[model samples]
Target: MSTVEACEAAQTCWFSCRAAALGGQTWTDGPLHWIREGAEQNLMFPTRIPADAVQSAVEEARETGVQIIGAWLGTEVDASALAAAGFERGWAPSWMAAPVADVGVSDDPRVELQEESNDYSDEYADYAEMLKLTRVRPQHTWYAAAYVEPGKAASRKLAGPRFAGRAWSHLTGETAGVFDMNVWPRFQRRGIGSGLLRAVVAAAAQAGARDAVLNATTEGRLLYETCGFRQIGAGITWWLHLEA
Candidate 1:
């Protein structure tokens, strides 16, 4: 698939998995596809929204009491309508992709990786704690975390997690989605990030995914690129706060 097509597929899979994990709702209206996780959260996908549809979506969000409405707008997508609807421009995140086979693996012995299939498990609690330390909300239900001690691999039952990430199954075509990757501030340069990434990407590939994709923060773009991900598309995030 072309990079743009791959990006779209990745996004669809990410949103679908997020909906499943969060008990969220999703719907498509005209050219707009809406994914809402709660009363306060809503996101529109594929950018390229027409002005009328943007206005309509905004009006609907207001009616439904959505506190935050987010959209990743393409370079060509008009920002005027969103701005008129009270949306403020935010950071641009890159949509990235890599072939499953091309993704690099980390064999760092100090980093021990663990996967959490149950959201309520203590392992997940550890993961959530790490996420909170990084100022990320623990919204997804499933995840994996990497841990380490001075001289040995950390045990889930004995030690706290230091970094967290997770991969979603391929929900749209053959593309798997990666989300919620974060490393603790002190562990920044350690191979913990790459180890966690490889573990999840390997899991997705084993589940029959041919390609892995994710949306990368500016700070994370280089790490992902070195691990075989390349930028396919870049988009600005627009946020509309109904309460404000």
Candidate 2:
């Protein structure tokens, strides 16, 4: 598969895990899969783009009466078509990947890494609070539960010392997708984030993954690059706000 296709598949798997954790239903119409969160909103992701299906997916999202609709268009999809459909292109995150040997390692003594337990722990709670503080999402507690629960079964959860930060790497076949890399505000600039990333990558490699992939935010572009991850493709998410 192409890098874009591989990245999209990995992302879809991660989203599926999150949706299952929340007991949400996933439905597919044509090439698109709608991961609906009750009536609050819907995540419309296209596994494969057929001609005109993108526009139909947008129409379906509007008909759902969802106040906000988020979609990630693969590199092969035409972004302008979605824009013409009234979906505003928001932050476009870069999809990056690197071979196991290229992933950098950290030798910082203060940075200790540990695997998370199946049941929730104090570290998980602190990590959720840290995500809330950094990302400014007060509802991250629910999101955290969705991520942590699925991760325990299908991914590796790596935590830094004193729960300063954490990251998750989910592997399927030979590709591993990294997600939920968060660091406490107080722990910023202390190499904890990098340390956690190194640990996660190492775990993926040891688990027999040939490569690792992640969608990097603007704030994390440099860090991922520093760790030998290079942009293989890009994805654009369009946000459509509907009338209540």
Candidate 3:
């Protein structure tokens, strides 16, 4: 498979995992994978173009009063197809990938810890609070936080938010997906983001992932490139509003 295909597959796995963790459901119909966490959190990923599944989903959403967000995996799918299906183009994120072996570890003064679990409420809270302090809104529900301390301090008082990110690996697979990597505004340029990224990548590597993939924001693109990740393609999400 092409690199974009591999990355998109890994991302689909990540979305599946997200649905499971958030008490949702996932299923596949033809080349489209559907993930639904709630009425407000329905998403579709099209792995192939000319997918009649998109039109069918739009019809279903119209009847159910639900919103459908379609994520176009790679360049193969034309934008007009989604437009025809009544989806409006939204933000585009860069698809990136790198071999796990090529991703180097960070040696910043702060201690890093990576946690993989179905629930990340505590970490998510810290991540959300950091974003709040920085006047940025938190975008994801799962997160790992990197704090600055003399050592692996056990108390929150002894450490502060340096960096935070989220990642998930497919079961019985070699691909992992990284998401929502962020450095607290006060900690930017301190190498903490690298430390946090390395920790997340290492966790996925330990979980049998040979390659790491992620959708990077324009602002975070340089940081990921510095960590040996290259842009393989780009993905755009289109929204279909059936909710009334």
Best by lDDT, which number?
1
Sort by lDDT, top down from the best: 1, 2, 3
Over 4 Å off in model 1, which ranges?
46-48, 106-142, 150-171
Better of 2 and 3 by TM-score: 3
Compared with the true structure, all predictions reach lDDT values of 0.65, 0.64, 0.62
lDDT, model 2: 0.64
Which tens-of-lDDT digit does each residue in 28-141 have in candidate 1?
887777887655455555555677887888787778777788886676776787787778999887888889889855575544434323334664553334332222232222
Best by TM-score: 1
Clashes per candidate (backbone, < 3 Å): 0, 0, 0
Worst 10 residues of 2 by lDDT: 140-149
Instruction: Estimate the TM-score of every prediction.
Output: 0.75, 0.68, 0.71
Output the TM-score of candidate 3.
0.71
